[model samples]
Target chain A: MVSATPTRERVLAILDTVKDPEIPVISVVELGVVRDVECGPDGVTVVITPTYSGCPAMKAMEDDIIAALDAEGIGGARVRTVFAPAWTTDWIPDGAREKLRAWGIAPPGAAHDDPPVQLRRAGRVRCPFCGAGDTTLRSEFGSTACKATHYCNSCAQPFEEFKAI
Target chain B: MSNRFFEYLLRLGDDRLVLGHRLSEWCGHGPILEEDIAMANIALDLIGQANLLLLKAASVENAGRDADALAYLRDAREYRNALIAELPRGDFAFTIARQFLFSAWALRQWEALASCRDADLAGIAARAVKESRYHVRHSAEWLVRLGDGTEESHARAQDALDELWRYTGELFLTDAIERELAHEGLAADPSAFRSAWQKDVDDVVARATLRLPAVEHWQQGGRTGLHTEHLGRMLAEMQVLPRTYPGARW
Candidate 1:
């Protein structure tokens, strides 16, 4: 039986059902974009952050949060965005990373905050399709802001890398 | 209300907005498919940052004006963007050169602002610091490539750098508004990071084999709402839809 009021856990569980609009395989909570969830007498407040500053998915995610809560009869829900510690791809947990790999997306590695910018980002990204280490970055910028395009030489398949930061 | 803070925010927001619009012009017209995507993505980031900054500015003004209103409704004369940002996107080399110069300065600017006493500004700046690092790397890499690519590419890159040098001075121009904010530790002082910016830019230019031009006369006035006659034309195209049907939504 459902409780009379939405608890923090309840709101969080609902949010877990809300998948990222860009990558539908992982939920927003799994992606760690949902910072905090609060439920009070007024209503529930879903505090979220953007994966990228200009990620178009942010609006969709916000709307999706509201819709998900509204569907559960949680009224007067509010969505707030806070950018303090800055979003990093590292926030995506190990379970979520495995899901991303299964979804044919190469999850990001450690997001080094202080690395000097390089002409070409160094390192080998294993192809998510065939688990091949031979891959070349086709473009640092990809179909989306948070992604980069890579060509797998071993499998001869094109893949997307969720960029590290 | 701190009028100076509002104006300062506007300056920061307008700079990104104008430059983002200029970059977006190359959406489909890029030299190549990858370059096209890259510019558009960068444009998205800049526009996103501008929107955030402008939203904060609107709240500070407490005038019921939203980011869109402040962005599309304001006249060119009312804009606070520096002249360098308002300049038209010239050639690919020119674009890359300007980007390198600007991003070098901006990366440091965001780094300094990350420590701002104002929590809101600091948060925005902190996020921006990460993005700006990418911007600097991307533009600097291109600058080096273009400068060393071939005779024609090198010459063009050098020419662009020389032509854009005069406008660079305005980026470091500070006034009473900025001075007060800096004193309060709520804002970054441009002069404080000037040397670091110069060193970073010089390093990239030298790597590219491009010589930095010495400006006999530094261009100014964009900070004071005096644009270089280019912002109005861009705004006309940008604001036309919003003006034609007020309150229009996509």
Candidate 2:
């Protein structure tokens, strides 16, 4: 009797064990870099797209994916990068958004449901420190390429907000 | 015709290479830490674009030189970048203004370039247009905030506009190479690009509550490689390490 689950599906199931080092809220799959999974008689090939070219996170993510799947008894896994139709913030899963809010960080103002025309709207981000909606932008650039610094008026604390590129 | 194609690519690549070098100098000196990282990120993107385009230029020219040779070994007079890209990174406001202006124009240029007759140019343009779109957005966002934020910021931004305005005209000046390329469907008409660029700048400026400088005598000659005194200083800094150790690599 054949097992009901396909090999590719089993590989993805194993990948869910790997968590993002910084956020630790979601696995690599929620990040949307895992574009496709293919399994053959020889081995399994994983196709991942980078959020940004030369992103440092990509190397670590690749290693984590490989290590986790190898522990699951699938030894021949190959990772490849694709650049066409580049990855966007919209690809981030809904589960990650909930995790971010629970972690005391404001979910990014840019949501996937919004059209491109709505991109010009001013982002009304709540302060991560005091959970206040009256935070003001201190600077557009942040500690990382993905975050920005903002000061909360309520608690008088400064915190980082993830900037939607 | 192929020479012209290579020439066009070199001009574009050199603009990015020089500006990237200027922007990198601010890696640690930005007004804030976030901005410091932001400028560094933008600098890296620009340098990456330069390498891609320069490599394409070398392949098209079939010259023995690769991207590195074309970038480092070339003399000041050999460079064909416009004056706007070569100007000093004067102040934070100045840097933002330069980026806003260049990125807007470049976004349009890359949009048109994506459909070039050459397969390589089209592919490169397609990849680059997305990056330039983000660059324009980032720079334009800063332009709006600084221009409308406070009296001091408004004045400083306007001053940057005034100082940099003279260099904008040369960006739309068509040359013999451009003319030849356009006829072959390999380039965009510079004149056709001006009005669109104007509309873009005007919309941002209006939103920022700022005004443009009155049309003034426009400077020219960067296309011909005749540069201001600043180029000498910039080249001295950028090429010094490479020139000192001819083939050394880290």
lDDT of each: 0.89, 0.78
For model 1, how does the per-residue alpha-carbon lDDT over B1-250 read when each residue is reduced to its tens digit? 2688999999999989999999999999999998899899999999999999999999999899999999999999999999999889999999988887887888888889989987888888888887887787888888998999999999999999989999999999999899999999877899998888887877788899999988899999988899888999999998999999998887
Q: What's the distance in Å from true for residue A163, model 1?
A: 0.6
lDDT by residue (tens digit), candidate 1, A1-165: 244668899889999999999899999999888999887766788999877778899999999999998898886789999988788888889999989999999999998875444566779899999999989987778889988889999989999998888
Per the 3 Å backbone cut-off, how many clashing residue pairs does candidate 1 have? Answer: 0
What tens digits encode model 2's per-residue C-alpha lDDT throughout A43-62?
Answer: 77888876544255677889
The value of fnat for model 2 is 0.13
Docking class of 2: incorrect
